[model samples]
Target: MLLNNKEHLNVSEYVDLNLELRNLDLEEKKKLIWPVSKSVDALMNFWNSEPVRSRQGYNDKSECSQLCLGQLCPALYTIMSDGLKPHLGSTFGPIANSVWQVVEASSQQGPLTKTLNDLVQKINGEDFITEGMLKFHAFVFGLLNLRALDAWFAYLCTRESILRKHYNDSSVLTRGRPDEPRPPLPRYPLIE
Candidate 1:
């Protein structure tokens, strides 16, 4: 019987499988287990084989991506908890380094400067984000959603602050600023 719509078993089946495995002797468990690299390769192959688009033009790869991400999160957490770093030659190192530059620049100007600066350092040196660095990817993925909202709020706050500054001092000159001159208003307008 199919445990889930997919060929794979669902959570309960996995639990049962785990219980069965736990009951096995050491030698039996060893025989059943595959190497970590084999598991990784299989997951990568699965991801690559998944259809990216359906006949109706809807995204089909989203489910694959979600499945991959689900596997990644726990793996990453485990890697981080174990204090292991990804191999030096992995492709993700350079990409993460480049991104760290942008994050570093943003850190200098933002509200979370200290936190961002610390994060930059964390991603530097031996802690670079590499293809094998699941924890780093997971951490960045977690941050991806908030980065947009943070940028938007920062823009609004900066605009409002500038307006207030101009309002309080008519002699205040806007230099190197992109915004067109406008009348100052309260940061939070009263609802009528």
Candidate 2:
């Protein structure tokens, strides 16, 4: 039986299929799995495909130009091209398209700094409007989340540096500099 009308799934049939899928044996489920290599190859090809690249239409002017994939547009276009739009329509559709507008507006700025500032402001502004009716635009935009990760990394590095310095100082007092180590480690040492 035809389970789809053009692209729309026959929901009742789809539910029945899902129920049938749940009753499958381990071997039957295993037969449905694609090989890992094929999966990876398919993903790589889709990510780097010509049409997706052309749709990105990136014109980076940042100091990290061309190398910087930090911008929002490319990431959105990559994941939401024609093939995936219908699937994402009800879910990611609202948020993605709303963020896309911020990307588009910020792209018009004369300088990279201005563009970034405008983008951030638009996303973070409480008054920001979108067709999707999304609230907390800043949270949805994900730039702030990226910045949080960066900040967390910086904190971790700082903590690591402090710990390394403490270790070196303690080692210097007990033994010597890291380069001028005197004693050999014991075979079954409890602590170094």
Q: Pick the candidate with the highest lDDT.
A: 1
Per-residue error (Å), model 1, residue 53 = 1.9
Clashing pairs in 1: none
C-alpha RMSD between model 1 and the true structure: 25.8
Instruction: Look at candidate 1 and tell me the lDDT of residue 72.
Output: 44
Instruction: Give the Cα error of residue 170 in candidate 2, in Å.
Output: 57
- lDDT values, one for every candidate: 0.40, 0.36
Model 2 segments beyond 4 Å from truth? 1-16, 19-63, 69-73, 80-97, 101-119, 122-146, 149-192
Task: List the candidates' TM-scores in order.
Answer: 0.25, 0.20
Per-residue accuracy of model 2 over 1-192 as CA lDDT, tens digit each? 453334443456556755564455333323333232344354456556665535565442431222223333243233212121121123444433333342333334455335355555565464545432232233233443355423422332334332232223222121222344433422332211
The numbered model that scores best in TM-score is: 1
lDDT by residue (85-144, candidate 1, tens digit) is: 122223455222222222334445456455544554555544445443443453345344
